[model samples]
Target chain A: MKDLVPERYALAFRLYPYARSPDQDATAPVRHKAIVVGGGPIGLATALDLGRRGVPVVLLDDHEGAGLGSRALCFAKRTLEICDRLGAAAPMLDKGVQWNLGKVFHDDRLLYEFNLLPEGGHAMPAFINLQQPWFEKFLHDAITAAQAEGAPIELRGRNRVDAVIPAADHVTLEVMTPDGPYRIEADWLIACDGARSPLRNMLGLGFDGRVFEDNFLIADVKMKADFPTERWFWFEPHFKSGDSALLHKQPDDIWRIDFQLGWNIDRAKELEPARIRARVDAMLGPDVDYELDWCSIYTFQCRRMAQFRHGRVLFAGDAAHQVSPFGARGANSGVQDADNLGWKLALVVQGIAPDSLLDSYDAERVHGADENILNSTRATDFITPKTPVSKMFRNAVLTLAETLPFARTIVNSGRLSVPCTYDRSALNGPDHPEMPARTRPGSPCPDAPVGQGWLLSHLGQGFILLTIGLDAPESVMAHGLTVPRLALEATPELAARYLGGAKGAVYLIRPDQHVAARWDHYDADAVAAATARAIGKE
Target chain B: MLITTPNLTRPDESYARLIATHEGLDEAGSHALNARLILILMNHIGDDAVLAEAMRLARETGTEAA
Candidate 1:
């Protein structure tokens, strides 16, 4: 941590964000041609992805900069694979705290502990927890740097969006700029606006979903404790009247605790410091001292938009769905929404693919949104049961799980993330010799090593030809696939683990990284035929 | 068997009795009613597509005029 960041960059907190106009008073004319309303991680990730592809984007946020709050931290192996595809992987790895095991507790009892690193390939490359603002700042810089190189994603900090109007073909956005109300036009509009999306409601979309009665108070503090810094330590729920406590580490030895407020506490009193101190005191022995850095209250909601598109106007991230921040899905899935949309928009803008290709965005991501909502709900339900009988049943099962290996696997798979398979989709291959239970062809492209670079499942911008063999086996040939980009690669270890070393296979992967098709023998003839049919090349 | 129709599927007839809020409902009452409505709808649609689409549409403008 010390060696990677330079002293000049260490003072980054003070030098960056370059204070801008107050969102409420200032009124600047239209600054961005296509404005992104929120500057959270998803919005910034979207800005970076688009800026790199020569698309000018305007990112606006009311905050002077990214929030100082420690919101989301965990990154899954799947997410890291996506990050690697977007060129944000290296910095993320350098700045985060990594862990690969998940533990569960039933009151004072340790119910189960499953080590995930081994399951995801010894080093797994998963679940990195970093301060959300750090990534926000990193992405903001990435966007600026991309602009300096060529096309930059325009950023209008401390600016607020008051109106959005979707018209024929192009969408016009009326923004309450630092100066006066200004309007801008774009070929498309996306509401990465967030859960309280004014843009969503302005469109009359029903945010039909469940809001858990439970509330949580998250406090960031600098503390010294004997608990291992790597695992999510869960305090006994019963000891704290059925609330859970978390210990997450940030840079500079700062830790964040997400204190799950009991159902009985008044929502208004959830943020009182005395209530927070009491919870912390319960967790500590008589001696350890900790200083509170910051605190906030948040409730959990599990909901997704009924549709991701309203004509040319689209919604991504929080603007589209809100999940309990339990299994690291909220921000990760939202960033993924940006990655999925960036290339689709670029291709359509460049006249490479018909605009209808955007339909695939909704087709794929809405499903992914469902998956996130479900996972977050499962984690939440397990941590906080609704009824005493269900709590007792959950505890009994968890207790039984401690002695049973198979049962623990079932529980951990949902919480820690099993590899996502896109089995029943239009993009996958017909039948292949190398298809394994885990490697179900259309599933998210599995990780493999190709020379100095990592061969990942989720390619950011275009279709990829992942040919696995010792020396480019010539089996997976790309001939008629004409969407964005394609590439070929291999690794001995990946072949053994995922592809089962059948002299490898050729995988025609889509821009979203779902395998379009794969074959043991790559006759440019057959591969080309499959690619044509998959992308409607006929 | 009824497949989850996603965006195309609305709530069943029985769900009409459940409202976003009941008379004299406080925050808790409103939230509970909302949850019941969602559960009923989810049980019918099964797939999340419809709600995801609704969210996207709503964000495009404002609270759905429906």
Candidate 2:
């Protein structure tokens, strides 16, 4: 307890340390193409996505690197896929503990076990349990490599944004560093400053949502034990540790344990090492020796801004929305927000796409935020049943889940994060009704083994004309933009995922690998119109 | 789904069994038993439309009788 330095400063690695930029010494405020505030997972990923697209972007953070503690442990398949696009998923998958099986328990009996990915042909697993620090570290490492390859990215540490002024076209910012305060401007401002977003507050925006009346003690413990890398959850645990408990294995030998420490607990007393160890002792028995790596008491709120985009400024990640940690939706959804916004912002900045394309970012990400909020809230309600009837129903569901397959579906031990399909998005183009719904308009392109590589690997960050069992021109010109064709023979996995009853389909995929439109065969006029609608030109 | 007329041929036997299930239970125990019974019955009546009708009828009849 004596060494109380923040985890960001105490990590084994030092990221972008505070350094004076040329903008700091300029005579007047320097205006940049894109300025991202906060160097968290969402911020860094956003900058990386934009930078890789040849957009000059700067990321400003108050800290040098990720703070201490294994904050977010579960990165879903969709998150890994997004990271794959950013050239960061390799290290994450290499270092992360991948698991698709999860076990749910009631009292001392096992209720049921479920596998997230039963039929798998995808490149990434169902989920990976990597500590948040490592997740951000991988993104930073990728940024470093991308910079070496001449991707226009500049990371500034210990630079806190003091103020932001938004006008019709650009945004003005006052940044404070260790040396002093300086003024800068950005054509577009992105706020990824986490849950308690100071930037959101500065802009006088309201992040309105419900806060559950409960507390959770998250303890990351390091031990030499042979626990399988699977997620184990308990309701009314037999050990009497708490109301509910969760155990997961991370990359290192460290295991994460979360105990639901009901509302109205002593903040200082509960944090005592002996008190926390008592709960751990009860769970692990007397023989297993373990050391507490880090622990914290967190009370979560399922919240989001009214709208993600406000004029010239955009909010992303926890700055735009927040959810309970039960479903691991927090960081996963944030990275998706970066994925959704990057291409649109890039096109808009390059003058290829109209400004209305950015509005779809607000429309689509707000949709994503709502979906995450709904799922996490439902999971929270089931975890902490407020009323006696709710508790009884929860127990009843658990009771029946032990033997009945139907009852098992009722049990909600966190729905877990899944990619959201913008079913009703304004940017969505025409959908082939005969095609599989999984790869319809507004859905993320399902990855399937293509040739030696994967389907998603070929949908390189641009408008793609993906043709299956058909021939198309090398590229089609649409609204002064080129849509290259990636031809492939219809494999069984691809047929099942992309082309259902339809024969020889042509798909118009957005830059973020989302299906915009599909047809039985290529028609240059139809593809061009769909491309126009996909980018909000319609 | 909510049979206004008698559907169970052995209605008395069924009522007797229901009463016997709560014989030795205290107030809270009886309440818990009733909850379990409701869930079991809900599972038996798998159709959501039928269950909704029964639920609505129960609410309507309870308010009228009270």
- Cα lDDT tens digits, model 1, A1-538, are 2322122112223213323434324353333335566777788777777778767777766544666666777777666666666566667778887776656665676767656554443223767778877777667666666677886566765456666777777676665544455566666777787888888888788888988988778877777665665555464555573367666667656777777776567766767778777776676644779887778888879998888977878889888999988777788888778877887777666665567767767877888888878888887777777886555544444554566554454343236544456556554556576545556555766665555644553354566656655233323434323433334444556666456636666667666566777767556566666665445343
> For each candidate, C-alpha RMSD in Å?
12.1, 2.7
Per model, the share of native interface contacts recovered reads 0.00, 0.38
User: How do the residues A370-426 of candidate 2 rate in per-residue lDDT, one tens digit apiece?
Assistant: 988999999999999989989988887888889888888879989888898989888
Give the chain A TM-score for each candidate. 0.86, 0.98
lDDT minimum window of 10 residues, candidate 2 chain A: A1-10
Q: What is the DockQ score of candidate 2, to 2 decimals?
A: 0.53
lDDT of 2 by residue, B1-66 (tens): 656787898989999999999998998788777877888888888888888999999999999999
Residue A229, candidate 1: C-alpha displacement in angstroms:
2.2
